[model samples]
Each structure stands twice: as structure tokens, then as C-alpha cells.
Target: MRTTHAHPIAAALAGLALLATLSGCAGSTAARSDAAAGGPAAPVPAAAGAAAADEKAASTSEGTAYAAPGASERQLARTAKLTLVIPDPAKAAKELRGVAEGLGGYLLNENVVTEQKDGYYVEPSTVTVAVPGTKLDDALDALSKIGEVRNRNVGSVDVTTDMVDLEARIASLRASIARVQGLMDKAGTITEIAQVEKELTSRQSELESMLSKQKALAGRVAMAPVTVTLRPPSVVIQDPNPLWQGLTAGWAGLLQSLRMLLTIAGALLPFVVLGVLIWLPIRVWRRRRRPNAPGLLASVLAPATVDAEDVPAAKPLDAPRDRPTTVDG
Candidate 1:
């Protein structure tokens, strides 16, 4: 019975050793799916979104180029500042309002100031609007009719590199996060689970931050700003100097000088006090160690000396030594 049991135990041990050797030779099966291990790379989803946007933009430009023969309509994405001077403010305003409404563009901001000049009227206006890239030309054409078009300028910035780089970074982070999630699901040990959770949290935060950056960039590219400044045909004159202007200016100067003085004092007072405090200790030490003057010396040293009248009379030492002392029985 002992021999039979030993044989079974030895067989089981041999089987376990063989299995471990096979597993060691095979290495990890997980590496088959990992791109770093000679595997095919995974598709980047965020990159696809950016690529689609570029394709759409290209298609849009082509469509606009072939819209009509001898058509001046162009698809442009840029920021512009326009200044217009018209004879009729109300009429121009009404006409531009219809054009803006028809273009699907709305006024983001508007300001109008009306004044009387030489018993006449003058209106100065400012409006900030955003229009679609496809309808920019139409919007600008309609707005130019409102005034003399003093300034028709546009500024553009190319963010292609920035946007593409951001997309790539976002995609990489998302891939890393997915891998971490898988690891978290498979992790059985407490240490491994904790590590995966920490990594996932970091990746999630980074992705959110990158996403915000992407949105801000997209908003900037999608909507172009057009600043329209409208002024009256004629100039308005005003008094060069008001009555209370000089007085107010003088008062302001006085207050400014007072503040300057106060600031200087605030900055210098600590150094001044520190210098005084430092000088005080040196002055005390010098006084303590100073050489005495004639009067001061006399006053300080006179008590240590005794006058001849206050001294006790001294016996003659030579006479006492000359006489030998006899021994007493």
C-alpha cells in the first residue's frame, strides 16, 4: 500500500512540472493582442474624428469653388474688423438687420450712440456678429451696402498642427485608459487592483482636460468673428476743454503725490528704524568702553586711594628685627 501511494504522488508532481515548463516556453498569450509585441495597431477613434473634419472642410471648399460661374462667393474662415460710414444710419441698420437674419447669423454684441451735431443728427454704432463660413461673403456684401466700407480686413490663423497633435494625444490616452480598464477587470490581487484604479483616475482626468482643449479649438475654428463699426457720414465736433477738467486734474495730481509720499514712507520706514536700532547698540558699547577724560578719571579713581592722615601708623620693622626674641619657659 505504501509503494502504491508513493507512485501516485510522484506521478502528480511530474505532471505539474511538465505543465510549468510548457507555460514558461509559451510566455504570455496577452502579448498577442498588444501592439508592442509585433501585433497590428489598433484604430485611433479620436484621430478619425479630426480626419473626418478635414475631409469635410476639403469637400466644402471644392463645392464652393464650383458653386456658380463668375461667382465671387468664397468659403473663408477668418476674423475681420469692418468700419462703415453711411449717410443714413436707421435705413442701413434696418437693411443690415434683414441680411443678418437671412444669413443665420446673429449679433453677439451691439452698441449705438446718437448725438446732435450743428443742430443735426449723428449715430455711431458697433456690432459684433458671427456668421457661417459658407455665407460669409453674402453677409459681408450685404453689410458693405450699409456704409462706405472704410475698412474691410480679415485675419486668419492656421491651427491644423495644434488640432491634429491634440487629437493624437487624446487617442493615445484613451487607448491607455482602455488597457488599464481591462487590467483592472482581470486583476485578482489587492495590490494590482489599487494600481489600476490609480492609473485609470489619472488617465480619465487627462482625457477630460484634453477634450476641453479640443472643444475650445473647434469653437474658434467653426465661428469667425466680424466686428462692424458704423459711424455717421459727417464728423461731430466737441469742446476741447471742459469747465471742471483743470480742477479735477489738479486734484488728482495732488492725491497722486500724497499716495507716492505715503508709499515711499511705507517702504523706507523699516530700514530707517533698523538703522537707528543698530546705531543705538553701537553707541551704548562705545560709551561703556570709552577712555576716561581728566575729570571723569579723577572722579572714578579718587575713592581707591587713601590719604596719609587716614592711614594707620606703621611700626619700625628694622628695629623690631634687630632685637632677637627670647624663648619663654
Candidate 2:
């Protein structure tokens, strides 16, 4: 009976040992496989080390800021200022307005001015058009056909990074607002609730401001503005007939001379009137002093008389003759 008990105990002990060894082997195998698949298992560091690493990563990412790095979704604000020589600016303006309307665009403003050229009035118009960004190229192409381009300036600004950063900031603010609101709802005290509400309002306002900015940026990106200035052709045709040319030239010269004379007369009229007012009394006083004054017209045309002293006097001819006669007798 003692031998059987001893044998049972020994077998039991061996089985327990065997089971422990198998479990150890399985654990080792799993560790080895994990090590092979992933990198070697590092000894777990203290919590402080992990925290520092996280902080470093956050700082690096924040410091690097956001960049649009060759992305397919690019935001560009396109604008163009163009000057062109069209045969007729009024007609061109009309056609351009039609084109803009056809392209689901509109003319923001327009002005047409008639200028004199080669004895004819040439109309030059300036128009500002707002069009969908997608149709900007098409509109430019069509407008180009209407005239010879005198000046063309096209520009684009990349706003991808700005837009992305704004979106991220807005999302973060919204999340903050939500969190604050949740805290407000769960607050146990009036003070806590008030504090949470204050923070929530701040974050909400910030979110709204960011959203407004986003809308503005999107508006610029969605539509493009183009300012087109249409000028008449540089060289204008003239009348070949000499008589007609001479007549027009004479007429222009005459009109210009008349205009200049009228300007001069207008400018001098004030001074002339002032002079008459001041001089009339002075003239009247001088005439009273003289008592033998000529009329205004006679005074203007009369030749000045020399005084007797100013003229050399003739010698005393009678005294000379008396002396000469006595001498001769």
C-alpha cells in the first residue's frame, strides 16, 4: 500500500512538471515569432519616457506646421487684368457681357467712354467680370478673340495650406466646444457650470469666426475676377481726300482756337472788370483836374504832345536882325 501511494505521488509530480515545461516552451515560441515579425521587444521604459516621446512628436509636428506638399486638391485664387485693342469697344463690351451671362457669369461693373480720334469718336470700355473658377480659362480664351491683346497679366495665389490649417483649427475648436458643453451638462455646482459655459461660448465664437473665414476663402477659390480694358486700335484710318482732310483740319483748328480764345477771355474778364471799377473814378478825377480831357476813344488813339521846354527854342531872331542892321548901316 505504501509503494502504490509513493508511485502515484511521483507520477503526479512528473505530470505537473511536464505541463509547466510545455507552457514555458509555448510562451517562448510566441515571443520569438513576435520578435521576428515585429522588431525585437524592447524592455518597457518608465511612463515618463513615453510621455516625453509623445511631447516631442507633438512639438515637432506643430513646429513643422501644415503644408500642401504636391497634393491633388490644390486651392488657387486666380485673377487677371487685361488690356486689348478691339475694332469697336462698345460692340465688344456687349459681346463680352453676353458671353459672361452665357457662362453663368456676370459683369460686376462696366464703363464706356468715347474719345476723339482721327476726327471720329472711338469708344473704349472697361468691364469687370466675375466668373466661376472652372470657366475662367474659357472666358479668357473667348475674350481674347475679340481684340488684339495689348497687355495681359494673369496671377494665381496658393491657399492650400491656409485652407487646410483653417479647417483643422475649426474642427479642433468645435470639438473643444462639444467637450465643454458636455462638462457643463455634467457639472455638479453652479460655479463649474458657469466656467464650462464661458469656455464653451469662447470656443463657439472662435469656431464661428473660423467658419466665416473659411467661407470667404472658399468664395475666392470658387470664383475668379477679371478686369478687361478694351481700347481702340492703335492705328486709325484717315480720309484720303485732301479737301475733306483739309476741311476737317480747318474746322478742328478753328474750334480749338475759339476754345482757347474763350478760355483767355473768361480768365481776363474778372481782372478787366476789377480794373474798370478801380480806374473809372481815378479817370474821372484826372479829367476834372485837366478840365480839357478827350473822350476815352480819343485818349486811347491821341499822340502825346511835347512840352515847350522839351522842344529846343528858336533863337531871338528879331534881336539878331536889329543888331545886324545897325552894323550894316
Candidate 3:
């Protein structure tokens, strides 16, 4: 009986050892297969694997967000001002309008001013046009062909940052509005609904304003404004004689002096007339108060002359002295 019991216990121990060996072999085979397939040689922990995946995803997103924009992605608003000297400004202005229309542009404004210059009517035109940004150069070239370019100025403003900021704000506002809408749907009380509605209205209004700004900015970026000033060729006075020029200049100076003198005289005439009116009345009153007094004209002339009867006779110096000495004796 003791031998049978010992034999059964030994068989049970051998079976347990064989099962352990099989499980170890299975694990080793799995590891080898994973390695052969370019996977981890050892089993990774689930938490560690998940953390690494999250880190990689975050890095990718960050890189994407901060990547530098290419040249085509840049937003620029361009404007140009040109002053052209042409033979006929009115004709040039009309031609410029056609050119603008041909190049996918429209005339924004046009003003024609007719003025008399040097005894001739001169028509100067100012035209403002909006053209596609891509065609700005072409439009300028066309303008150059129309007349002599006296002045040309081209300017650009980079608006990429502004555009990006607008887009981000719009996205944020939309998300916020969506969240508010979800809250509205779930709101249970009247007060909650009212508050949610108010917030929604405010956000919607803000969104509309933002959208309007975006539209304006985008329009500026897409279209380039060009201002063209068309002026007739300057009139050249071609008098070859220096003497004539001097005489003309002297005559002009004389006329200008006369005009200045007239202006000054005109300005002083009123005050002079007022002073005369006041002084005449005062002088008349003083004369009327003292009628016996010498006339003012006579009083003023009295000091300048002497009457013949009032003058004393002069005696000869030698004769007069001898007579006085005899009489005293």
C-alpha cells in the first residue's frame, strides 16, 4: 500500500513539470515571431505603449501647427499710385478705364477737373481702380504705355498674421457657439434658457462682425487698388529773348506791386474815412465855440511871416552913435 501511494504522487509531479515546460516554450515562440516581424522582442506594458503613442501624436500635431508657411500661403495687400503726363488727360483716362476692365478690374472712382491754365482749358483726370492682385503688374505695364510716367509708387502690406489670427478667432467663436447651442438644447429651466439665448445672440452678433471683417480683409488681399493721376503735358513758354523775358517779369512785378498797393489802400480807406468824419465834426465845433479867435489857417501861417508896419527901422551904426553922444553933451 505504501509503494502504490508513492508511485501515484511521483506521476502527478511529473505531469505538472511537463505542463510548465510547454507554457514556457509557447511564450518563447511568441517572442521569436514578434522579433522576426520587426516588433518588440519583449512584451511591452499596455500603459507604456499608450503613453508613447500619445507623445508621438502630440508631437505631430504641434509640428503641423507651427510649420512655416510657404510663399504662396502669404497674404499681401498691394496698392499703387501713378502720376502720368499725357497729351490729353481726358482721352488717357478713358483708355485707362478700358484697360482696367480688360484686366478683370473695375473703376472705383473717376474725377475730371477742367481749369483755365495759361489762357487754355486744361482737363486733369484722377482715376482709381481695383484690379486682381495677380494682374497688378500687367495693369501697371498697360498704364505705362498710355503716357509718360512722371511718378510711380508701389506698396505692399503683409497680412498673413492677421489672416491667421482671424481664422483662429472665427474657429474659436464657432466652437463656442456650438457648445452654447448644445447647452441650450439641454437647458431645463426658463432662466437657463434665457441666459443661454442671450449668450447665443451675443456670440452670433460677434461672429457676424468677425465675418464682415474677414470679408473686407480678404477683398483687400485679393484686389490691388491703383490710383492714376492723368495730367496734360506742361506748357512751355518758349520766348528766346532774354530782354523780353526780363521785361515780362518786370511788368508782372509791377502789376503785383500795384495790386498789393491797391489792397493796402483799400484796407486803410475805411479807417481813414472814419477818422476824417470824426475830426471834421470836432474841428467845426471848436471853431463855432470861438468865432473871435484867429482862424486856424491864419494862426498856423502867422509864425511864417511878419507885417511891414511892425518892423523897426535900423540906423547907420557910425552916424547914430555920434548924434547920441552930442545930444548927451
TM per candidate:
0.47, 0.50, 0.53
lDDT of 3 by residue, 1-329 (tens): 44433433333223322322332334344233322322222233345334434543453353334332333598888999999987766788899999999999999999976676775546678999999998999999998899999999999999877656555455444544544454454455555566668776876797688667667777888899999998877777775798988999999999999999999999999999999999999999998999967777688777667888899887758654454445555
What lDDT tens digits, residue by residue, belong to model 2 across residues 55-103? 4345335433332223357989888888988776678889888888888
> Model 3 reaches what TM-score against the true structure?
0.53
What lDDT does model 1 reach?
A: 0.60
> Which parts of model 3 have CA positions greater than 4 angstroms off?
1-72, 119-124, 234-329
Query: How far off is residue 255 in model 1, in Å?
Result: 27
Candidate 2 residue runs with Cα over 4 Å from true position: 1-72, 115-124, 235-329
lDDT of each: 0.60, 0.64, 0.68
Window of ten residues with lowest summed lDDT in model 1: 66-75
Better of 1 and 2 by lDDT: 2
> In candidate 1, how many Å is residue 240 off?
14
Counted clashes in each candidate structure: 0, 0, 0
Highest lDDT scorer: 3
Model 2: weakest 10-residue lDDT segment is: 35-44
